[model samples]
Target chain A: MLEYIGKRIWQTLIVLFLVSIIVFVMVNVNGDPVQSLLPPDAEPWAVEELRTSLGLDKPLYVQYFMFVKNALQGDMGISYYQQTPALNLVLDRLPKTVELALAAILISIIIAIPAGAYAAVKPESPFSKFIMFGSLAGISLPTFLSGILLILIFAVTFSWLPSSGRGDAAQFLGMKSSLFTLDGWKHIIMPAATLGLYMVAMLIRLVRAGMMEVLKQDYISFAKAKGMPGRIIYIRHALKNTMIPVITVIGLQLGRLIGFSMITETIFAWPGMGKLILDSINRLDRPVIMSYILVVAVIFAFINLTVDLLYYFFDPRIELN
Target chain B: MQKEKILEVNNLKTYFYTREGVVKSVNGVSFEVNKGEILGIVGESGAGKSVTGFSLLRLIEEPGEIVSGEVKFKGQDLLKMSEKEMNKIRGNKISMIFQDPMTSLNPVLTVGRQITEVLIFHQNYSRKDARRRAVELLEMVGISSPEKRIDHYPSQLSGGMRQRVVIAIALASNPEILIADEPTTALDVTIQAQIIGLMKNLIDKFNTSMIIISHDLALISEIADKIMVMYAGDIIEYGDKGKLISEPAHPYTQGLIDSLPVLERDQKRLNQIKGLMPSPLDLPEGCKFKPRCDYAGDDCPEGTELFEVSKAHFATCRKAQFFSKKLMRGVG
Candidate 1:
């Protein structure tokens, strides 16, 4: 068991290492960070000092090695645009993104499983058809588009909740509690719902497909033959097996959720990493952008690790391995 | 007769609807299983044997509907029950076994967990009680080291072991009726023989009636007391297994028996039945079997009603009544 776990950890590190290389290369592709950091009348001496201080005057390979070393030590260097610690700036905005991703997953699972399982059980009942066909719309409509429609419906048209921003003047962690409280839920409701509902639709479809496959399995038939109740047969036997694959997709989706939340956050003007990344881009804050990107990637990697752990529960063979 | 019949299916019709048309899978089929008897249902694929088993359990969801029929279990009409009530009786009183043990048992669950899950729900046993009973079931099913195997997933066990787990789970609640739908079809020859023997011993011990549905004639011949030969959703022949195997009365039955490869039988080679069984949607006019029957004639096509050929034998063949003596040697 220890050897197996050790092997998995080794593979995980390899994957993360590969992700870091891709991220580094892609972030650099838009050209020099120095050009964007400077204003109209910078003196040669000022340019030299900035380059020297920022470590940009070093060889490219030297810069990359330095960046890796600093990143490992939890110091992501300074933001070229904001003139602050890139790590601190990114971490400040981290919680909001994490919160949104968590809420989205929670809501998606709650909606997807029952809808999918019920649809599978009845198969072609009018109710089943309603679920199966209705989910098609969920799958087809992009989440960003859904977010826009929701913004119109709840924020612009109704004007009932705050259109943008994480919260208002009320006291919560660094803000008013109502912004983070029962009432704050009202504010986050639209944006989170917009993002989450689309995921729910995808999840429902995946779950339904998994359930349809599991329902035909021999254990299910055995349940039916044994005079076990339909509800029991569905939940206890069929649904459990169905979760193994669905869990895999959900884990992969959690990583996707972070990627998707970036746009939705900026659209709603929520104080999350999405907006932070956009702000960093507009300011050409090289340190902050690279650091924020790294934070998001790390979160994605962490969620996947937890999901990998969950695999053992769904399938015991995984745990044994 | 009334007391003897634990389960009786009458004039049952089950049809599946596709874009092409309605396929009459099980049409006008009737039979009865007495208490504690192993009633074997034998047929080729697409003969609706599995569908019939599904119908009895009311496991057929949509795209397929019970067009008409009465499935009476213990004098209670199962077909008329609400889905809710039927759900109550499903796993408690009647249990089903399936072919391909690998596909049947849930791979994620341990054999212990799978068996205990049924007991916990249907038998109202506590988790501890269920677990205890699960070990007993494992041991009873001839699984060695069952105490440890109970914690192992279905993939860890051999085909025979998985089949045993499937059987153990089926008998978990002491279901009055066990439906084994080709339970040993996916198993090796030796494993199949072992499982069949295990099932026979368990049935006698529990005194539970069974409906063993399979297309393998030889397998059923070993255990079934009364065997029914099914074709195109209808039961074409019915009798004692010995009598049916030794002296089949219907042309379809004769065809099947002749097709079975026998050991050291010197008289004749194994005869292959001619023509494919027609698609259920485009079934032949006149007799459903007319296209494939060597004995078929103008009147033979018209003979649709089942005719008694012996004290305990019945057939839907006109030739059985007119020329019963001639076909007896071919089958016997």
Candidate 2:
């Protein structure tokens, strides 16, 4: 198990390295952000001076080497637009993003698993048909459109809650989070629902398909033949066996949720890393954009690693190696 | 004196409502298992033997339904009982072991846990007591080092050992009627003998009435007190073990017996029945076995219900009555 974990960690490092290279190349290929920082009427020499000062005058390979070296030492360079450490800016909003993403996933899981299992058990029932079609609609609608529609319904039409922006509230642990407070719950409802509903659709389908397949297995028949109670048969024998694939899908999607929260963040004006990244892109803040790409890549790799580790707990058939 | 009947089935018809047509999987099959007797059901593939076993437990799934049946266990009509009531009788009084031991047991659970689960659910054994009984059950099935073997998952065990575990789980609550559906079919010949031996021993110890379904007549005859031969979802022949094997009444049963290879003699080719079982959806107007039977003729009657040949033997064949005079020499 230790050797397996060590190998996985090594693989993650190599992946992160490749992601850094891709981020570096992609960000550089989009032309210089230093050029954009200068005013439209500024003199060419002033632009050159600014470019030289920022080390953009150096060869591309030399700049890449410098970028990588600095990155290794926990330095993501400084944001040209904000004049602050790029990593610090991304990190500052990390907690809020994490909070939102976690809540969204929590909501998805809380709704999807039981709903999916129930649907799988009664595939032809009216209740299951409603759940199946509802998820279909959820999947069909894009996140931004769904987010806007939710705002119109709850905030515009009903006048029940705030439409945009994080709630006007004090910070919890230096992050504007509604995780603990009831007011935060009200604020989080719209964004989380927007993000969670889409995920719930995918996860519900995954879980339902998985449950149906596992329930058909011979072991399930054996369990039934043993006269295992309906509850134990469904939950312990059927559902537990169904979760390995669902967990894999869940793990892969979590990384996507973190990255894809950009639209939801923009729609709601949520003060999170997604919004920060979007603003940086609009301004073409190269350092911040590059760092955000690398951070997102790292998170993706980290999440998959955690998922692979999680496989050992759910499925005994899987040997760690 | 005649032994008390432990299980009785009357005209059990399990049909699959498929897109093409209704597949009569177990059509009008009826038999009885006496107390402490092993009734072996023998047939070729797609002969509805397994379907018969599944129907007994009401384990048939979607697209298939028990169209009509009367399954009485210890004089109580099992078919008339509600699912909740059936659940109480299932593992506690009537349990089953299936074919393919490799897939029969849950791969994720330890064999011990699987057995203990049955004991706990059916017998109301506490965890500690169940664990102890699970080990004993394993031992009863001839698994070595039951304490350590109990912790191993089904995947970790060999095919024979996994079969032992399946039997152990089936016997966990000491069920009065054990339905073993082709239990040893997935095993090697040596392992098959060992498993059969173990099962017979366990049945004797528990005074369990058993229904052992198999395709091999020889295998069934070794453990079965009475033998039932099915053909295309119908019980074509059924009788006391010795009488049925010695003088198979139906032509299909004779073909099955003749097809068995003898060790002492070498033949140019093995005697085999000419054709496969007719598709259940397109069964003929007359007897199901008529097309396959060697003695089938224009004189062969349309009605194919079991006709009593002797005191305890019955065969669903038009030629069964005349076979005693014409083909009596064929009997060894």
Candidate 3:
């Protein structure tokens, strides 16, 4: 198992390296940051000085080599717009993004698993039909639309909670998190719901389909013949078997949730990396974009590895290698 | 000696309400099993042999149900009992081993857990006690190193060993009536013999009444005291194993026996029953086996009731009288 983990780590490093190269090339292809760095009315000499200092005047290959070299030493240059370390800027916003992503995932899992299992066990029931219908609506609505609709309902119509921005946060483990405060939770509810709604729908369908399949296996019938309680048969035998595929999709969806929470974050002004990356993209912030892409790539690799490891736990037939 | 009847069924009918039509899977089958007796129900695929076993336990699932039946176990009508009450009987007084051992045991769980769950649920044993009994059950089923093997998952075991684990789980509660549906069909030839031998030994050791369902006549004849031959949702013939194998009253039973390859007898081609079983949706007007029987005549299309050939032997065939006469001549 240790050897397998080591091999996976090596593969992850190679993936991150490729991602770094791609991010560098893509950002460079988007045109020079110097164009947007200085004002349009700025003198030619001022532009040249900025370009030379920013290493934009160097050859593409040279600049890429310098970027990789600096990145290895934990230096991703300074953000032209923010005048701060690009890696630090992304890292500072990391906790907020992770916090929101975790909240969204937790919400999805809490609602999806039991609901999906219930739907599968009683596919013809009225409640199950309602759940399926709700999931269909959830999946059909886009994140931005859902975010706006949530604001319109809970914030505008009823005035139940704050519509936008992360409310007052408490410092926990050196990270400012809204998770610890009730007001923070109220502020986060809409944004997290918007971000997680699609995932919940997808997961519910996945879990339902998987549970239905598992319920038909011979082991399930054998369990029934053994006079196991309906609860044990459904939860212990059927649900555990359903989890292998569910976990895989969950891991993949989590990566997507963290990476593509931009629209929801924008709608709610959740102060996460999504907004930062979006603003950076508009201003051609190369350092922030490069570092952010690399970070997201690392997260994807990490999640994939975790999913592989989870397979070993869910099924005895799956060898770690 | 008059044996004590452990289980009795009267006009049991299990049907599947499919999109096409209602499939009369087990159409009004009636039989009984005696204490410590091995009753073998044999037939080709889709002949309702498995459905008969499932119906006995009330394990029939959605799209299928025991529409009508009287299943009396220990003088109590099982069909009339509530599901909660039936749960007390299942896996305690009665248990079942399914076909395909590779799939019968949950791959994620240790074999010990599967065996122990029955003990825990039905026997009311504590976790530790159940684990101890589970190891013993595994050893009883001929698994070596029960201590270590108990913790191993079903995927880690061979096909024969997995089936043994399945047998262990079935016999965990020492059920009086064990219904095994095609238990060895998924096993290799050698493993099939071993599993059959183990089951026979275990049944005698525990004094368990067994209803072993299979399509193999030879396999069933080896362990069954009474043999039942089913064809397209009906019991075509049923009698003492010795008499039924020696003098089959129905043509289907004869065909089943004749199809078995003999070592000493030289035959270039094996005898096969003519025609597939008619689809349950589109059954014949009268006798279900008429199209498949070689002796099918002008009068064979009429609905034929079961005819008594002997004191306890019966066959649902128009030519049962002629077969009985032939059998008498052979005996005399």
Candidate 4:
């Protein structure tokens, strides 16, 4: 088991290296760092000084090494706009983004797994037909459109909760302070809702297809023949078998959540790295933009690694080696 | 002959409802097995032998229904019971072991959990007790190192070993009647003999009745006290194993017997039965077997009921008297 874990760790590190290089190359494309970093009004000497200071004057390889060195030490240079340490800025907003992303994933899985299993079990039922169409609609619909639809309904119509921001800290973090409890949840509500709707739809469709295929396996028939309870068959036998494929989608979905949260974060005005990246893009803050891209890349790679481990645990046939 | 009959299936009809018109899979099949007797139901592929076993356990659900029948176990009708009540009988009192032992067991669960889980649900045994007894059941099936092997997953085991695990699970609850559906068909001939030997020993030791369902006559001859031959969802011939083999009553049964690739006949070229069993969807107006039977004549009609060909041997063909040695050659 230790050897298997060691192998996976090695593979993950290799993937991280590839991701790091890709992130660096992507951030640097389309413009010279000097153009983005130094304003046009700046003196030629000042441009050269800024280039040398940021290590852009050095060879690309040297700059890359410096970038790697700072990233390892958790010094993500500085934000181009705020001029604050990029790492600190990203991390401060990181939690909000992660929490929302996680909520989206959790909500999606909760909706999808049961819906998928039920759809599989009763293929011809009207509920199944509705769920099938609903899932398709979910998968095909744009995240931005769904976000807009949600904002219009709960925010414009109901007006029960704040339309944006992680509400108040006391509202979210204050359980003992009863008045702050609803406020905390309300603060994060719109962002969570916008992100969760599309994810729920995508996840439901994948889970339903997975559960349907699993239900048809010989082992399922064997389980039923053994006279096991229907629920046991669904949860234990069918669900476990369904997970290998679901995990594949999960890996893809996690990467997607981080990559696509830009729209969701923007629509709800949630203070997250996604919005930070966009803000940095508009201002052309090379350091902040690069750090945001790098951080998201690292997260995607890490999630993939964890997902592989989960697959290894769930599927007995999959040897970590 | 007078032993208490544990199961008696009478005129059972199971049809497969498909997009096209219904396929009459098991059409009006009937048979009985007494307590402690090994009754073998043998037939070629598509002969509805496995369907008979599945139908006995009420395993055939939606898309296929037991259209008409009385499957009585101790005079209690199985078909009439709700799924809840039928489930009680499936793995406890009347357990069934399916064909393809590899696929029969779930891959995800360990052999130990799979075996013991049934005991927990059916007999109300606690987990600890069930686990302890699961070992005993594994040992009973002649699996070596039952304690060590019980924790192993299905994929970890060999084909023969998996089959043994399947037997252990089937016999875990000490079922009154164990149904072995082509249990040996998946293994090599030597392994097949060992499986057959293990089953006979286990059946004798436990004193539990069994219905060994297979198409191989030689296999059925080893354990079956009585043999029933099925053709196109109908029993064309059925009687004592020795009598059926030596002097088959029905023309189809005789054709099957003559085509046997037994040890004594190995010196000569093996004979294969000519033509397939008639389709159940489009059976002959008279006898279903008339189209395939060598001794088929004017009287050999589908409507003819099984008539006594000998003292105990019964056959469905009407022209049994006109059958000759010359007609036997036409089968191969």
Candidate 5:
């Protein structure tokens, strides 16, 4: 198992390296940051001095190597806009994004697994039909629209929740998170729901389809023949099998939730990496954008590795070697 | 001798309500299994042998319903019992093992867990006691080093070993009867013999009545005391194993017996039944096997009901007399 993890970590490093090169090339190939930084009436020599100071005058390959060397030492240059270390800026927003993603995934799992299992077990029931219909609607509805609707319903009309921003956060395990406070939970509910709605919809369908397929296997019939209680048969036998595929989707979706929660973040003005990345992209803050993309790539690799490891746990047939 | 009937069925009809039409899979079949007897239900695919086995345990799922039946176990009407009551009887009083050991046991579960679950559920054995019993059961089923093998998952075991685990699970609660549907069909030829031998020993040791369903007539004849031959959804021939094999009264049975290759005879080619079994959905009018039978005559299209071919032997064939006489002359 240790060897398997070592192999996975090696693969993850290669993937991150490729992602770094791609993000570096794509960011540099776009219009120059120097052109955007200086004012229209600025002297040409002043612009040249600013460019030299920012190290933009160097060749692209040399700049990339310099960036890589600094990145290896936990430095990712300075954000042109923020005038702070790019990695620090990204790391500052990382906690909120991770919290939101984790909460969203927890909500999706708590709702989707039971709902999906029910849909598969009693597929002909009215409640199952309703769940299926709701999931379908959830999948089609855009995050911005859903976020606004939730804000309108809970904040504007019912006045049950705060519509925007992260409320008072308490430090837990060296990370400031809203999850510990009731008021913070009220503030977070809308954005998390908006961010997690599509995942809930997708996971429900995946779990249901997977459960249905597993339920059809001969093992399920044998379990029934063994006279196992319906609860044990469904949860212990069927749901465990269903979780194999569902876990894969959940890992991938969690990575997506953390990285691409831009629209929901924008709607609610939640202080997270999505909003930071969006701002950096518009201002052409090369350092922050590069760090954000690389961070997300690492997250993807990490999650994929975790999912592969989880497969061995869920299915005994899957050998780690 | 008057043997005790452990299970008796009266006109059990399990039908599937498909989109096309109602598939009468097990059409009004009646049979009985005596205590300590091994009854084998033999047929080709789609002949309702497996359905019959499932119907006894009420394991038939959606779309397929046991529309009408009276299943009496130990003089109690099993069909009339509540589902809760049936659950008590299933796996506890009457356990079942399925074909394809590779697929029958839950892959994620350890063999010990699967076996112990039955003991815990039915017998109310404590976790510790169940674990101990599970090892004993595994050892009884011919699995070596039961101590270590108990912790291993189904995938870790060979096919024969997996089937042995399945049998161990079935017999964990010491069920009065076991229903094995095509038990050895998914096994290797050599493994098949070993499994068959293991099952025979286990059944005799426990004195458990069994209904072994399979398509292989030769395999059935080896283990079954009584053999019931099914065609389409009906029992065409049923009798004592010795009588049935020696003097197959029905033409279909005769064809089936003839199809077996004999070691004494160096035949250039093996005998085969001329045609395939008729489709269940669009069966021919009258006899279901009329299209496939060489002895099919003018009167056969009207269909023939099962009649006594000999004492304790029944067959549904118009030319039963002529077929038996031909068989007798051939034997002489």
Candidate 6:
């Protein structure tokens, strides 16, 4: 197991290196950092001084190596707008994004698993049809539009929930969370639902297909022939095997959730890394943008590693070696 | 020699409602198994033998339904029993082992856990006792080092060993009737004999009634006291194993027997039935086997019931008398 983990970590390092190269090149591609930093009326000498200070005056390859070296040491230069360590800025906003994604995934799993299993068990039933069509709608609609639609219904029409912003937060495991407060939960509901809707839609389809396939396996018939109750057979024999594929999709989607939360966070005005990345992009704060991308890449790698471990845990056929 | 009837099926019709039309997988099949008797069912591919076994356990899935049938186990009508009642009889009184041991057992579960689950669910044995008994069952099925193998998952074991585990699980509750559906079909040729031997020994030790389904006539002849040969969705011939093998009144049965290579005879090629069984959806108006039977006459009747070909032997063919005489003359 330890050797497997070591191999995964090595792969993660290579991935992070490639990601850093892409992020750096992409950030630098959009015009000059000097022009974006200095005002239009500023003296040429002043701009030159700023360029030298930021190491932009050096040869491109030298600058890239310097940036790579610093990044490898957990330093991605200071944020152009915040004038603070870009890594620190990204890290500060990481918790809120993690919490939102985690909550959304939690909601997705609770709704999707049972719904998918039911649809698989009775694929042609009206209720199953409703879930199937509802998920289709969820997948088709954009997260931003869904977020606005949810706000319109619950916040604008019914006034049962908050429309935007994090309301009355509490501390959870050293991170600010609204989970402990009713008002906070009300405020988070729309954004979480919007993000979770897409996940639920995808998961339902994956889980349904998986469950349907698993139920057809010979083991299921054997279980039924053993006279195992329907519920036990569905949950223990069918569902457990079904979850194998579902868990993998879930792991890959976790990174997507964190990456794709930009629109939902913007609509709800939730303070998260996605929002930070969006703001940094508009201002051309290269350090912050580069670090955010690097962080997300790392997160994706970490999740993939964890997912491989989970596969080993769930299936005896998957050996660590 | 009236053995207690452990299971009896009456006109069991399991049909699949397909997009094309209804496929009568097992059409009005009736048979009986008595205590400690191994009844072998032989058929070609798609002959509905497996479907018959599944129907007995009510294991048929979607698009398929047991339209009308009576499965009496120890005189209780299983078809009329509620799901809860059926659950009690399943695993506890009636259990089944499927074909393809590689796929029959759950890959994720340990062999021991799979067996123990049946014991715990049906016998109400404690987890500790179930575990102990699971090891014993494994050993009983001829698996060596049961202590270590008990923890190994199905994938870690060989195909034959996995089948032994499946047998162990089926026998965990000491079921009164065991339905083995092509249990050795997925194993190696050499392993096939070993598995069959293990199953025979286990059945004898437990005195369990068995319905062993297979397409191999020679394999069935090894242990089956009574043999039933199915064509399409119908049992075309059934009788004592010795009598059925030697005489084979039905033309299809004769073809099957003739197809077997004999050590004494150096025939250039084995005999084979001329054509395939008619598709269930497009069955002919007359006899179901007429299309494939070489002895099929123009006046062959449709839906012919099993008629006595000899004392205690029955065949569905209308021209059994001619074949009986022909076979007698050839042998003499």
Query: Quick one: RMSD of model 2?
Result: 2.0
Rate residue A67 of model 6 by lDDT.
Answer: 97
lDDT of 5 by residue, A242-306 (tens): 89989999999999999998898899999999999999988899999999998888899999999
Q: Give TM-scores of the second chain, every candidate.
A: 0.94, 0.96, 0.95, 0.93, 0.96, 0.96
Which lDDT value does model 4 have at B43? Answer: 89
Could you tell which candidate, 5 or 6, scores higher by lDDT? 5
lDDT of 2 by residue, A1-321 (tens): 899889988998999888888888888888767668887898989988998888988998999999999999989999999999999999888778877888899999999999999999999999999999999999999999999999999999999988876654557777556687777778888898998888899989999999999999999998898888789889988888889988988888888888879999999989988999989988889889888888888888889989988988887788886
lDDT of 6 by residue, B1-332 (tens): 88899899999999999999999998888888999998999999999999999888887887999999899999999999898999898888988988999998988888887888888889899999999999899889889999999999999999999999988888889889889999999989999999999989888998998999999999999889999999888889988898898877888888788788888776788767787778789987657877776677766755568878787688887375567677645643
Task: Please tell me the TM-score of chain A for candidate 4.
Answer: 0.88
Query: What fraction of the reference interface contacts is present in each model, in order?
Result: 0.77, 0.70, 0.78, 0.38, 0.82, 0.77
* DockQ of candidate 5 relative to the true structure: 0.83
Off by over 4 Å in 5: B299-303, B324-332
Local accuracy by lDDT, each model: 0.81, 0.88, 0.90, 0.79, 0.90, 0.88
- The local lDDT score (0 to 100) that residue B74 gets in candidate 4 is 88
Query: Given candidate 5, what's the lDDT at residue B297?
Result: 72
lDDT of 5 at A245: 89
Return the TM-score for candidate 4, rounded to 2 decimals: 0.93
Q: What is candidate 2's lDDT per residue for B107-126, written digit by digit as tens?
A: 77788788888888877889
Candidate 2 local lDDT, residue A314: 80
Candidates 1 and 5 compared by TM-score, better number: 5
Interface RMSD of each: 2.2, 1.0, 0.8, 1.3, 0.8, 0.8
TM-score of 2: 0.96
Question: For residue A71, what is the lDDT in candidate 4?
Answer: 86
TM-score of each: 0.88, 0.96, 0.96, 0.93, 0.97, 0.96
- Which residue pairs show collisions in model 4? A116-A208, A167-A187, A171-A180, A171-A184, A172-A184, B286-B301, B286-B302, B287-B301, B287-B302
- The TM-score obtained by model 3 is 0.96
Cα lDDT tens digits, model 4, A46-70, are 9888877777777878878988998
C-alpha DockQ of every model:
0.57, 0.74, 0.83, 0.58, 0.83, 0.79
In terms of lDDT, which candidate is stronger, 2 or 3? 3
The 10-residue segment with the lowest total lDDT in model 3 chain A? A30-39
